[model samples]
Target: MVAVLVIMTAGALLGYFLRKQPKIVMINDKLIMLAVFGLLFLMGVAIGSNPTIIQKLPVLGAQALLIAVVGIAGSVVAGSVVYYFFFHKKY
Candidate 1:
């Protein structure tokens, strides 16, 4: 955890110093996307190689879907409440 935070802080400081360089910014964006896709592909491969997960895929899919739906519903309800209270203007 400390190492992760230290690396992240170092990266943030580097990025701050490099903020004026558009070329570096563009390269950084591409690198970030490549890293994300690589991690996702590796994760899929790991999950695919697990037989237990394969067997429970259907149930896991249903649970994931339920959790996602509930999360979205809760976010929408909470956001609406906040907007109504703080940002909405009466006619």
Candidate 2:
């Protein structure tokens, strides 16, 4: 946990210092994209190789779907309320 926080802080500081350099920013974007793809690929490989996960995939899928539905519904309701209170004209 400490190591993770330290690494995150270091990355934050690096980003802060390098935010002004356009070339570095472009390179950073590509690096981030590559890292995301690599991480996703590794995660897929891990899940594919796990027999326990394969057996529980149906339950996990159902839970994920339910969570996604609830999250979207909540977000829509909250956004509508905010808009009605702050942005909608009373007239």
Candidate 3:
């Protein structure tokens, strides 16, 4: 995982440098969206394939949903606080 992350970071830096060259163009949003959906679908399929996991999901679904909601809310609140403090530039 660390190696993968390092490789991805290196690739992103390389892309950023190359993008400063004159001939580059932005990628299409449609392709980006399609790649996102494809990755999400594959993740779902991997998670769905475990029969033992699927069997217990009914009992755990509400707990999972609650955790997910709380996590999302926490991230949004944290992001807003960071932005207000650092990016507002008025202080």
Cα lDDT, all candidates: 0.99, 0.99, 0.85
lDDT of 3 by residue, 26-91 (tens): 453456688999999998998799898899898689898999999999999999999998888883
Model 1: residues >4 Å from true position, as ranges? 87-91
Worst 10 residues of 1 by lDDT: 82-91
Pairs that clash in candidate 2: none
lDDT of 3 at 90: 88
Choose the strongest candidate by TM-score: 2
Tens digits of per-residue lDDT for model 2 on 5-77?
A: 9999999999999999999999999999999999999999999999999999999999999999999999999
> How good is model 2 by TM-score?
0.83
Residue 30's lDDT within candidate 2 is 100
lDDT of 1 by residue, 14-74 (tens): 9999999999999999999999999999999999999999999999999999999999999
- The predicted structure with the larger lDDT, 2 or 3, is 2
Q: In every candidate, how many clashes are there?
A: 0, 0, 0
Error of 2 at 32 (Å): 1.1
